[model samples]
Target: MADAPQEIEALIDMMARLPGLGPRSARRAVLHLIARRGQLLAPLAQAMQAVAETARECLNCGNIATADICPICASEARANGELCVVEDVADLWAMERAGVFRGRYHVLGGTLSALDSIGPEELRIPRLLDRIEAENITEVILALNATVDGQTTAHYIADALEGRVRVSSLAQGVPVGGELDYLDDGTITAALRARKTL
Candidate 1:
């Protein structure tokens, strides 16, 4: 890094800041990109520029989009009267990657946290409530993470919409590949509570 040009060092530092990348990995990546500048670096730069210029949050759902409304929000087929609430755009993307959920989504940006001073007003809760009425949503499926803040946010949303619409949450429990011995107490408890007759 000491021998490298200032601009190259700066690029490495920037890449190192990305999630899952360390300084060593970033240095290697920068070297690789420099070696293949014509084939990879130029194209990557163009693509990044394009995305930076066009990407925006969907007006209705808060999903990342290149337009005012994301494709899911604009599609008539996705209006299934079910809204899946999530803690972030990453969560929404994860749900989409699974291809199991078919309805539209509402990204909350983040969970409520008293320590962080984050409340319902800080997220998209008010927008979510508005969408429930505007879209004639029949059910809201909370897909938040199992963290304490996530659960707290879910409870708050549930209580807020108690009588207005049917509200539910994704089941919490031990994962399919998890063993009882390896599972935590809370996971075991949730699994037992959610056990079925089958």
Candidate 2:
């Protein structure tokens, strides 16, 4: 690093600031990119530049998109009256990856956190309520994480839409193919509570 040019060192430092990356990992990544400048570095730089210029949140669902509305919201087939509410775009993407859900999604941006001063207004709770009527939503499936904050947010949403529409939550439990020995007590309890008859 001492012998590296200032520009290279700066790039490494910037990369280090990325989530899950440290100075050592960023340095190694920078070295790898430099070694594959034409094959990877240039293309990656171009892609990042393009996304930086065009990336914008979907006006309706808060999904990342270049246009005003994301493709999911734009698709008529996705307006199935079943809206899946997630905490972030990452969770929305994860649901999409599963390919089981066909309805649209609502990104809350974050959960309700009293300590952090994040409330319904801070998230997209109001927008979600508006979307329910506007999109003719019949059910809202809370797909928030299993964290305490997530459950708090879910309960808040459920209470808010109690009479307006049907509100449900994603079942929490053991993962598929998970061993009982590896599961925690809370997970085991949740799995038992959510058990369905075959």
lDDT of 2 by residue, 1-198 (tens): 588999999999999999999999999999999999999999999999999999999999999999999999999999999999999999999999999999999999999999999989999999999999899999999999999999999999999999999988887888989999999999999889889999
Q: On residues 1-198, what C-alpha lDDT tens digit does candidate 1 reach at each position?
A: 489999999999999999999999999999999999999999999999999999999999999999999999999899999999999999999999999999999999999999999989999999999998999999999999998999999999999999999999998888878889988898899889988898
Residue 175 error for model 1, in Å? 1.7
Extract clashing residue pairs from model 2: none
TM-score of model 2 relative to the true fold? 0.96
Per-model TM against the reference: 0.96, 0.96
Cα distance off (Å), candidate 1, residue 169: 0.3
**Over 4 Å off in model 1, which ranges?**
none
